[model samples]
Target: MARNTIRKDENTTRRSKKELILRLSVYLKPYKKESAIVIGLMLFVMLCSVLNPYLLEIAIDDKVANHDVMGLLEIGGVLLVLNLVAWAVSIIRWKKIYSINNNILLNIRRELYTHIQDLSFDFFDSRPVGKILARVVGDVNALKNLFNQSIQLLIPQLLNLALLSIAMLMLNVKLALVCIALLPILAIAMFCIEIFSRRRWEIYRKKRSNLNAFTHEEFSGVKVVQSFAKEKDTNDEFKHFVKNLKKSWNSAVRLNDMFWPLVELSAGIATVIVFSVGYKLVISGEIAIGTLIAFSMYAGMFWRPIMNLSSFYNTLVTNLSAADRIFDILDVKPDIKDAEDAEKMDKINGKVEFKNVGFAYEEGADVLRDVNFNVEPGERVALVGATGAGKSTIVSLLSRFYDVTSGEILVDGKDIRKVKLESFRNQMGIMLQDTFLFSTTIMENIRYGRLDATDEEVIAAAKAVDAHEFIIKLEKGYDTEVNERGSRLSLGQRQLVSFARALLANPRILILDEATSNIDTQTERLVQRGIEKLLQGRTSFVIAHRLSTIRDCDKIMVVEGGRIIESGNHDELITKRKAYYGLYSAQYEFLNEGA
Candidate 1:
């Protein structure tokens, strides 16, 4: 699974630039109105900026040159007022743009999270939690910059360039044409750099996500790494990941580094041409000294905006790559979905039936073939089998985690597929051998099974499962933090807590997949007692490793190679001397000899 995650990261790093841009545009569609307003304000700001240089020209040529003090003061005052107004507008525009950009990012994050929740178990099974989180946090952040900085800067810069060009033409058309001619060449250079940078930036973003996934996995399994003395090996692997990350980052930076210098070179060439032509015009007395100076200033200002625009374009491409990754998650259709006319069930009778059930994870290999079974309300059925047998698969099918390839699973004679998924899952409580607990207080973890459960009810449930004693022994009692995955608690204690959780849910159907496997003998006895109470009125499926745990179940099914070889009550199966008998005899003899 870890190797597969790394491979997937490497593959995503190689996505084409076109696909990334298309995906980013789709994400921006929802915020188009706000984006338009931002662009309009940006253009307004640019117009004001371009007018400032022209205003300087007027102040120089008309007021200062003529020695008209009053005129100079009047023009100077107006320019001051205009500058102040432009500054205020720029601030206001930035505030509004950032507000809109952040809201859009929030919406994207929310949508991505909701989509992740909606995806099927199969999707989650194949993807790492850290990788998904990186997409949500890291990738989305990159897209935020695209909206807030890249778009905001690009629009204004382009407008400044356009307005400056018009002003230059008004002053001297020949000089304007010469300055503008260099723009196409500069633009072509920027375009080439942007193309190279886009690919490298995509690689950089994907490598960052990969590093995040690796770190997440390492921390998640830190205990295993420590126990197996593989920390050095893990660190070596991480160093390799970082090496690739650095390479990708350097490649992107190097490409971007060339951009500014190229813009400077183009502007420098245009400046030399403008001055050479303007000096001749000045010598012939065709243009004033002030006009020549103002022309040079505006010409430089014009190329400055062009340079900014080019930089914004580069940033836009990088952001688009990040947005593509985010949208890819959003575009994935959930494998399981509620039917158009799916109805919610308010009450469940807990009678389940699997009719002509056949299932397979992949083609050409059957996990469960033509499996037929029915469980009455309030009956406990024990499914016993070896590791690869269809026992766990049957429980998964019952929970509708993955629907059978060819079969109909009915709950109270209603096809499960036709029922709302949320309501359907609410009807059952599942306790796996390895229970997962949040990094929260014991009370909160218990309350996870039923969010609306009260403190008193939580305590009662824990007491019923023999977990209350140890829970109260903790310094903070029910409020003591579990730390990630309940690291503070023992396996036996964790199992007890899970038992209490399931019991508190008050579900009509209960599933225990080797639930007591991790508990000690003494704790197992207490858990067994709790299970009996929890199952008293609910239909239950017990996937047991220890035959003694299922000895008294209403029905015991011995499954081998996806086929049920023996089915009966404990005594009946033992008397029959079949598969069940053999299994029970072997376990009983082992225990007796060990004792």
Candidate 2:
């Protein structure tokens, strides 16, 4: 089984790498004009490289040795001109390459981000934020070098090698034959390096990804670590990841370092052979002194490309691993998407219905089963259940965060799946127990609900939520900066700000999952009034841990074991003296004890 698993992994890696190469090539298609110019310039550079040595041959044999001082000076001037042209071509090529590469990278990153956003909430539920972030920020960065080296080094080196080979054949056939003989041996050596080095590079990339995931998770939860006094434990855990990364990096680098020395050695040996055989040819009057000298120069030029090619192979191996990871994300099909012929759903009456809705994050572990419910256009419904009873899951389905596994959800008599995603989502507002705010000012966070909301509208939303009083009392009022995750604000304050945001969105369908669970009693009263105001004339779903908060809701639902066990108005449920009654009585006693 273990061997089978390893084989499967190997096959997956190979497939991913192939797919990565193919998909990345698509980005280059848009830059064909620039690529053509670059290739032309590189060919020009290669021409200069090939001609420089031949020019030397002429200067030595026909100008210098013949004592034609003016001819030598003229040849010198031509050589300088050739170099200047190559330099200018190189400058223009570099700028174009940079522009093309940067644009490609930007497009790739943007596509990844947009794809991630389109994915269903279930995709995020299975992966950590840190792991996803590594792919977006770190893995995407690996392709930067891939494009840079491709045009700048790989193409030019290959062109130079081909042109140099042709020049050598024209100058001296015997020396060219010798150079050709050495290529097969060098090629085999590089082929061996690439084969042996790829596994190590893959390992190195995996370790680096692991390290990044751990670092991001740890730092983001630094407060929890400090509160639990687990600093030492966390540090030790981090060190372990560091140690693994170091080991993988060392293994990869060791293999990578061997490639250079081996290429250089091959080049050196080839040069020595040229000198040994060419000297004999010159002595035998088979070739001129200048020809032998030029042959020697060409031999060096040939090996330089071989060395570069080997280095490029090493780079390819490293980047292929990163590319595989990036494509892994790109290839994931979004679990939720609109139907092919989905229609736009603009104005909604806010009537929501669940027709035998059933869902599960994993197969056979249903979180909701045959759940049927309905709410009028402006009803406030509260879902109450024990932990893991799927209250939040119900709300998630209502908001279309995850599609129902067995049935359908409809808004204003229209199936949500048949509506355009953006059009459907724009009509709804959702606020979770953990109110998240960006590391920006209060005004901006509220404005996030509606990007085009005027300042007056934003203030109106704040006032509607009863947050304006506290906003004005703050050190900078609406302009005050809320630290990351709104750490700078009190928990109650964050809830109010988030409430303001939801209010500003003016969504017809509002879903709040434990929105007030974190607030203290005093603050809960303050927020309760705002919540009442927000719920007016809007269909709302509330999931709450505190039963008292839902007593006034039009309908109270009791969920258990993925089924709605009881549901009714608070008075009706209390009259039954069943599950809801027991829950309320228990909560009432707990509150009295606290008092």
Candidate 3:
């Protein structure tokens, strides 16, 4: 397997702050009714807060200092009732916000996953799984926090500030003027912090993603590392990734920490200025003592939401980078998509044809050039070649995992590219050298081949592949749990399960890529019987490593340097004494030496 270089530069995808918000809000459209209700509740909640200071003003002026006991009690009762209503509304509002936030997260993650599934093999070839995982997991999680703040915090805070401003100005223009003057300074400070913090966060996220990629890669291939005794080397590489993450994490945290204090300092300064002026006005009788107290209370209300807004701004700036990374993946249009006029291939007869096919993994570097071949329905064809000689590429093209750079692939005499991808792929079954099984019961793993398959049908498929005996022998039988990647099962057992899965699909065309390479000779004999029956009446392409396995192929093509150098039956090829002869002779000699 080739290790692809990680392109660090691709992580720094940037979008304008305005565009990011607008794009995210698109998810909010589906739940507009809930959003509206939440916003309305926030408005009423702002009214409740704004009314408190004015009520205090009246309570102090006309009841407390006036020594009217009943009036004071009445005011207290009103305040209590108001606070109760505000609290209740807040609880309901947040409940709704939480629901909306989770739904949006679910939708975004689903969309990302679906898009990734549709992408061509080349996309996966170019990027590591960890990089993609970061976007799907960590990045999506960050967006959830932003959504929560946008509804439950940002919108309400802005309304609170606005309503508080109006109430303050009506009560006393002088105090209100002084309080509002600090707004511009707070805004400037926030702007400056946001600019600096955004860059730090972007770097931090990239480092975090890099760390995740490295960890996933190492753990996934742990066996290889242990076999080569490269644990120390791998640990060193891990430390290198962690050190980079720590530096970026520290830098981002340091910048983020500075934000709260600046916001609090601005609020603190506003408080001092308001009180210094309000106290003198009260002493001079220009404003009543109650009015002075009310102004101070209103000033607190005003600055509190400013602090909230500042917090929201900080969150927004940091998460904006995450949003950009997510959109980068969503923006990748799949290179292979059904054409506008593509037809649905309902029932394929599986006559495969490659007409002047040419392909390349990269430009000007052809992997297969002008490759031409044809397989009539029910023909069993064997593709033989050295490593990287393009045997696998041929199967990939036939399955339309990739499109030919030049020429066409036809199924049932119609160009496959002109057929709907899903319909075309549904009729094909592919078994690779490495078979992947999900963490689930053996029954479910086999049923994955055809989701609609019945339990008996699943067991029947397993039986067809000679997997039933071992499966039934297990303590749990078909219900036995296969751990991740079917790690608990032997490699041969895993391959058998895969064969059962592919067989259950019952595809019109079958592709076997070194499928029997892992089985022991005894097991191989049993599997071969099953395979022969499975291959009957289907167009099959087999890539075989063992020369003997392909002896029964109707036609054998000797692939060399990305072209079909020769084609004949096994006996005819051995007699020709060319490339196939060389391969057969080497294998025969090896088997004889072992004997």
Q: What TM-score does each of the candidates earn?
A: 0.94, 0.96, 0.97
Question: Against the unseen true structure, what C-alpha lDDT does each candidate score?
Answer: 0.84, 0.85, 0.89
Ranking by lDDT: 3, 2, 1
Return the lDDT, model 2, position 463.
90
| Model 3 agreement with the true structure over 1-595: per-residue lDDT tens digits | 1334443534456899999999999999999899889999989888888888898899889888879999989989999999999999999998999999999999999999999999888789877899889999999999987898888778778778888888899889999998888788778877888888899889988888888888898899999999999999989988988888899889988988887888788878888899998988888889998888888899988888888887788889889899999998899888899999999997988798899999987544888988988899999999998988999999999989988899999999999999999999999999999889999999999999999999999999899989999999988999999989999899899999999999999999999999888888988988987898789889999999898899999999988888989899999999999999999999899999999
lDDT at residue 221 of model 2 (Cα atoms): 90
Best by lDDT: 3
lDDT of 2 by residue, 1-595 (tens): 0111100122224554456667778998999888888989988988888889999999999998889999999989999999999999989988999999999999989999999998877677665566677678887888898877776777778878888888999998888888778778777877787776777877777676677777888898998999999999989988988888899889988877887887778777878888898989989999999999888888888888877777667777777877877777778788789899999997988898889999987545888999998888999999988899999989888778788899999899999999998998898999998899999999999999999999999999999888999999999999999999999999989999999999999899999999897889888877777888889999989999888888899999999999999999999999999998998999889989999
lDDT of 1 by residue, 118-199 (tens): 9878777777778788889998888777766655776567667778888999999988998888877777888888777878
Candidate 2 C-alpha error for residue 3, in Å: 21
Ordering by TM-score? 3, 2, 1
Model 3: lDDT of residue 226: 99
Off by over 4 Å in 1: 1-3, 7-10, 13-41
Query: Model 3, stretches more than 4 Å misplaced?
Result: 1-10
lDDT of 1 at 273: 98
Error of 2 at 250 (Å): 0.5
Candidate 3, position 58, lDDT: 93
